[model samples]
Target chain A: MAKSRVLVVGTGGIGTMAAYALEKGGLAEATAVMRSNYDAAIKNGIDIDSVQWGQVKAWRPTAITKNVPDVSKGDVAPFDYILVTTKNIPDVPPTVADIISPAVTPGKTAIVLSQNGINIEKPLIARFPTTPVISSVAYTGATETAHAKIYNDDPDCQKIGAFTSPQVPAATAAEAAKRYVNIYNPTGTLDVLYDADVAKVRWRKIAYNGSMNPIASILRMDTPRMRMSRHIIDDLIIPIILEVRAIAEASGVTLQSDLVDVVIHQDPSDTGFKPSMCQDLEKGNLMEIENLVGEPVREAERLGVPAPTLKIVYGILKGLQLRVKEEKGLWEAKFQSGNSYE
Target chain B: MAKSRVLVVGTGGIGTMAAYALEKGGLAEATAVMRSNYDAAIKNGIDIDSVQWGQVKAWRPTAITKNVPDVSKGDVAPFDYILVTTKNIPDVPPTVADIISPAVTPGKTAIVLSQNGINIEKPLIARFPTTPVISSVAYTGATETAHAKIYNDDPDCQKIGAFTSPQVPAATAAEAAKRYVNIYNPTGTLDVLYDADVAKVRWRKIAYNGSMNPIASILRMDTPRMRMSRHIIDDLIIPIILEVRAIAEASGVTLQSDLVDVVIHQDPSDTGFKPSMCQDLEKGNLMEIENLVGEPVREAERLGVPAPTLKIVYGILKGLQLRVKEEKGLWEAKFQSGNSYE
Candidate 1:
């Protein structure tokens, strides 16, 4: 059988890592789709660097920008799977929907979402009902540094499964998992868990993200220091976790562990680890505050669960966002004035 | 009549300002008492440069540090008023109490607190019951730049009043107010209000301080940007103000207006103000968070008024404090390591 063609969307840390892993696993011939043409070229070059295998040379994948020609017109072949690893910002989902609609052949293609947070899966499924959409939880940490180089903090581990009504066939899902495991499991690197309780997994991830990310971001502290500080655990993290858990329970998702336990038990010596939310905050990028903290707090209010802690933190984070916006405005004004003087 | 001798204790911004105003208004011969010998000498030199008339100006009053000789001998008279302007940290009240105890004389002397916050009046009054303790609110701004120069942001105004219990006999309080108004009203700079609603005034000031200061500290943003940012107002300031109001209401003090209007509607263009809290945060000095937000929120909670917003911002601020502590520890460890190497 001909090798299945795969299109990995987004050339960020996660997207680049996924493409690299897929090509190394030999499951499919992958092409990374980046938003910028410059980024696409850079990402393709990095894929080429990852091609050198153990004591032998290996394969390289193609890179395509968002402006890639139609697959039906023979410009590029149809992809068997479209993996999206972009941040679920306001424009991302719709952008993905528009780009992937023409490339998707229902029943023949699968689109996997490996982004953060919950509630995204349902919306995408609603948008493309016929297309097989797989919800994925990535445990690995992939960091993108300056000059667009991708480094995998966690070498290999991913949890992928189907999350839908009239769920995809178990046999087919298992086969897909096996294929992924085999491809990425060089030197036994990837662990594939076929979780029927994917919602639980998603909520568990959300709990961790919700607790650590915002606290780290707002405080501008790394995860280890945040974990080590009892003040942070008692004051910010624990209350937020309890509130998030309440929201999860109300939404029918059972998170596996309590947030405080996870934070306290997590090693403080892992000083190199920064929550992704902190990375976004440092970059002055738009945060997932609404989805991470706001949505759960809003839900808790609807459920009549008193989430005072979450409400306050959400307000603070929102306040910081506004302050940053105002500063940017002032900076822009000054910059324009300077330009006029020049 | 000879000018009543006055000693300005805790010669920081407020203390120095009071001294300058008092001398300029020709109501008192003003002496400054500072914690350090350097500060006393510096402040004395500053007063010499800035004094308006050469009559009281030649009376360089006294500039004495704690270790200075006991100048108040048998024939030498004690100061009529001791104006205390110490910082509102945990160490402040005890330190100030110890320093000014010797200066307190039952009928002849009174202590005026020209500092920020609400709780200091009760403690000082309790400590020195026989001596009059007047709580005064300063509305103007001052910054100390040099040993011989002090800059006033709003030199045209200062407010002084008797805000204490077992009410300093109305006649005595009014006379004291008039005396203070005369002395600190250089070119009529002071505004003295002698209403029974002093608690309300203090609470209103507390509301403004609690709302603007801590958030400014946390975000490291200046007043104009913070006030202009709707996010900060909605997320941080308003909630904090609400918390303050709730606490004030619980304490039976009627606040003048909703704090939100004060923060949101306050003209940012006029003041060129940056909150003292931000200055403390930038300097990594101990913040007045406990007194400003924590104490009020705790009071509100004790009163069964939900201060969710205040609690969260307080938590985050506390968290930031802890993070700073950890960083300090790390820096100390690194320094110790370097010392060992040396």
Candidate 2:
């Protein structure tokens, strides 16, 4: 049988690592879609210095395409799976779903979403009604230190499950998810586990992300400083955890009772790690606010759950996101001169 | 009759203006205590470029003292009133009350608090239990552009009231408050009015300060930008206003009904004004967290009022305050290296 073909849409830290893992497994042919880094990657390939896999010099995937649509032209075989590992910023236009839609062969391709935040599969599910959606939660301290140079400190572990739709039967979706995991984890080096309910896993993950990410960004503190502040842990972090739990419960996902304790102490006090959201703000990049905090707050409101903590957190992140957008020239602020109070 | 001698403690923008006003009134002998700005203020005086009171070069008070203690060294009459116009950052050590305590004559001199926040007088009342505590809310757009070069855009107006205590009769406290206003507004050039309930007035002011000041600082937005963000107004600002109202009500002060709308539209869209707290953050100065947001939240908790929004806001601001303190070497953070979760 021909090798299973995979198209990775985003070649950021997570995408590059996932593609590298799939190719290293020697079960599937992986093609990376590099936009700006295409020339560098095509010429030099990717230099990955990872703790889990050691140093791999100038490693290239089976093929490299500048654009997604370019890979589909001229009698090419259809891709079995298209994995998206971009930042889940739904607030920005030309979302990941739209960007990867050109190459998707509707029902033939399984769309795998490996990113942060809860409800990230909604857009992909909306765009591809009949296609199987693989919901994935990727955990790896991977980052691109320089152009075409990746640095990963943590092991690549992914919790994989299928987003069951009425169009795709549970058995079919699960089979698709299992197949993708099998191709990526053939060597069993990467700890990729199949989860029966990825949505519950996402809720658990967001309990940490929804609390720590935005708060760390807003406070301008790293993990160590945040954990050190007693008020932050008790007053802010715990409340947000409780709020997330309420939101999850309202959405029919009952989080663990010890979830607050789990989240408060998730990072070691000396870790001093800055969350991705915090790094985004520091670099003036658009944050993953909409999916991480905004949607959850809106869902809470829709479900009649009192998510005051989340609402305030979302409000603050939204304002900060606007400032970032305005600074980056992605959005403009409109104001008129008049009296403040009448 | 001898002129009423008044010593102004904090000579920041507001303190400088108050001293200028009291000296300009010609009914009181105003003495300004300049700590860091003493040399420049004594050498150049305060060059006033006022919108209300036109340009006055080298405007000196009745006296200029380097330290509050020095003002009482020689054969000098006691100060009838000590007006404090510094930032209400009670979190920092050597509070304004403590700094001005050396020159205070407990029973003879009435301590006037012309600063921000609700329970600011608590410290003063605690320090000088027998002394009458006069609470005043000052509104002015004033800044020191250069060394001792003062700029006043908005007119100086103050709502004066007395903090009635069992130690001091309401009539005596009210009489002291009225007397200070009379001295400060003898010529009526300054719009100083007497308020029967300054606590209520402080609550109303905090509806703006508590919502706008911290949010602007956190978002790095000016007033105009804040008002233009509809979600910020509806979700963050209004909810904070409601929380402040709940806190105020639980503390025995009922806020107005249209407070949310009032706070929402308080600043004109084109004002582009950065509240004092925002400016403090920009300049890396300590914020007035204790009195402005901290006290209210604590009061709410004590009174069993659920101030979720305020608590979250306070939590965020507290963390940021830690950052500022760390930057300024006012505090040190301690962290330990261990497993985050067991």
Best-performing candidate as measured by lDDT: 2
Pick out the ten consecutive residues of candidate 1 chain A with the lowest summed lDDT: A333-342
Error of 2 at A30 (Å): 1.0
Off by over 4 Å in 2: A70-74, A340-342, B70-74, B250-257, B340-342
| lDDT string, candidate 1, B267-304, tens digits | 35444456887787787766777667777777777788
Candidate 2, A159-246: lDDT as tens digits: 9999867788899999999999899998666789889888788999999899999899998789778877778888788888888898
- Give the C-alpha miss distance for residue A149 in model 2, angstroms: 0.6
The Cα RMSD of model 2 versus the native structure comes to 2.0
Error of 2 at B61 (Å): 1.1
Query: Candidate 1 docking: what grade?
Result: acceptable
- Native contacts matched by each model: 0.30, 0.82
